[model samples]
Target: MPEAYLWDRPDGGVPIAVAASGPSSSALAGEYADGVIAVEPDAKVLELFDEAGGGGKPRFGQVAICWGPDEADCRKRVLDQWRWSPLGWKVNAELPGPDSFAAATQFVREEDLVRTVPCGPDVDKHVEAFNKYVDAGFTHVAFVQVGGESQPDFLDWAERELLPRLRT
Candidate 1:
């Protein structure tokens, strides 16, 4: 991952997808005007603390950074409450990337310096998911697919399908 991320919020209500890791924390903050809650794999807890939980104005709420206590132990915590968790509603299982709670938050309101790569689906999938995010409320998103044969196709598809729709 490049350790930097960006998301656009057109509707300004709810973000589309949550990525993963500390780099994407800003998006999480962007999603919440009040506060942000983060859920991550146990392996990434320390990374998240160092990246997002540090000192600053805090993005979402006054507290800004609220990390899940258990880390890996809190999969249910994320699935049940996190906005992106497809628990109650019919969320497109096809995500923009690794639907990590942290990533979801990072790509919402503010752009952050976090490495990210395209995940989930091919170019068509990316377009659909990105458009879905925008239509739903997200205004920010980028094609960050890492080293892969499909990278160019992903970008091309974005320009052809996604950009046209986004154009005012």
Candidate 2:
């Protein structure tokens, strides 16, 4: 009965999506799932998915960003919270756990974070970072704001400035 009820819902069935990182998983998602969720704006992954019959399906991506009133503070937040980002997917996958991640990323500096994540109040920087995903064929993108307490501020800024530019 529960299954029947779900199937009878007004909005129709919920679409299934698979989170994919590498080539095999990306192709599998194309063959088996309605969509794919990727950690980065990688065109190669999207190409693999599409070649595996995922054309026209939603391609979701997640990008990390640090936004704040001060660029220096935003960069600091990225270094403090997301220093491991520049390690690349291979290194991150090889790390066993949080402690390993901490140890592995200890040497990563603010400049590295800056190179990977758009940091600060500069709207153009954030937009440029997001556009990479779009250019990579991502139909949807989610921003992982690095600073925990600044979510509200980020949302406000996104609504006022970020979204507008992105629309055009």
Which candidate comes out best when scored by TM-score? 2
* Clash totals for all candidate models: 33, 0
Tell me, by lDDT, which candidate is best. 2
Candidate 2: deviation at residue 120, Å? 0.5
Model 1 regions more than 4 Å off: 1-127
Candidate 1, residues 1-168: lDDT per residue as tens digits?
Answer: 799888875675663333333445543533432333232222242234334533232212100111222323223232333334222112323344555544654433211211111133333433444454344322234433333444465466556655676564
Error of 1 at 14 (Å): 24
Q: What is the TM-score of each candidate against the true structure?
A: 0.26, 0.89
Which tens-of-lDDT digit does each residue in 1-168 have in candidate 2?
555643365485678888887889889999998999987889999999998889999999998988899999998888888999999887887899999998998899998889889988999998999999999999999989997799999999999999999999
lDDT of 1 at 99: 54
Give the whole-model CA lDDT for all candidates, comma-separated. 0.35, 0.90
